[model samples]
Target: MPSASRIAILGAGALGQQMAQHLRQQGRRVAGFFDDTCPSATTAEGRVLGPLAAVATEFAAGRFDELLLGIGYRHMARRQQVFDELRADGIPFGQFIHPSAFVDASVQLGPGVFISPGCVLDLNVTLAANVLLYTGCLVAHDTFIGAHSLLAPGVRLAGQVAVGERCFLGIGTTVIDSLALGADVRTGGGSVVTRNLPEPGTYVGVPARRLR
Candidate 1:
């Protein structure tokens, strides 16, 4: 277990509240929320925290050291905007991994990442900032997942694979060993990537190929 830290969540959606509940249950202090629109006092799962905007002053005061972005959208442009704004404002973000996820000691995860339940990260897997690993995903040894990527449920990356920035691996997709997925790529559900994908496009089907 890590030391207790003061944290704030940016969104009040399902993912945001789930993270808050998980962290609170782990004995970490959740300071407040910073939603664009005000969130209800009780979240979907009935986790009660105060008003969402209470952290505005805290953000300006430099009191909170960590922040989490809980929006579930896969739009890289919007995500990058938020990241750039936060970076300009100088709030350091921290990665959130569920206690049940199995991560090897050799793995290095970047800030503002979310690793959900039943996930396994093998040795030396490097995940860049703001990446999301959905439930039951498996990333094998020596894989590099770039910044702002999202691995949907049941996605698997074999050893030595390299995924570029802002990529999305759909549910049940599998990437074979030593393959390189280019930047801004998207793999459809149940696709099998056997060759290197060098261009950015939506790929689907076995031995994945770009559709457009």
Candidate 2:
């Protein structure tokens, strides 16, 4: 279990607000949000605490013990940058598993993982740190999702699939069994990945083909 029961969200966008609600429903306290755009403002979830610049100070003052990076897939680089900065500042990250999600006991999960509502992770699945599985996503048995990968809503990974770091599977994308996708791969919405994608690039279509 994580040491902190309270979490401070790092973004105040739609996903951030949704995460706040989910965390609250899980019985964890939502300290507030840290967003530059909405500094000192009130959100539907809670108050916008301040900009990212205030993180180290607030953390040192014990305002919140853990952080959830609520930035979306479009800003993957920013997410990684902020995570690195906070990690270097000795700020801990928290994992948020929605109450409706199903994760097998044998599954291995790393720090800062977020599994959204109705998502399922099968037995022996391994999700590395900061992996994000949005609503209704399914990761089958023995699958491996690398660090900072994002699986959009309803994305499905068949058994034994391996998704590399910083990959993004768009909404409703499906990857068949035993496939492997290299780092930084991006699949368009509703695409079906039928084979191993060893190179990093954007893909789309019924049988996913590199677009760029």
| Residue range 23-121, candidate 1, lDDT tens digits | 777677776666656654655534333343444456677656688777664567667668667766677887778888999999998989889888999
Candidate 2 Cα errors over 4 Å, as ranges: 1-4
Clashing pairs in 1: none
List the lowest-lDDT window of 10 residues for candidate 1: 45-54
Off by over 4 Å in 1: 39-42, 45-56
The CA lDDT of each predicted structure is 0.82, 0.91
Global local distance difference test of model 2: 0.91
Residue-wise lDDT of candidate 2 within 1-212, one digit each (tens)? 32346799999999899888888877788999999998999999999989999999999899998998899898887877888889888999988788788999999988789899999999899999888898999999999999888999999999999999889999999999999999999999999999999999999999999995
Give the lDDT of residue 78 in candidate 1: 64
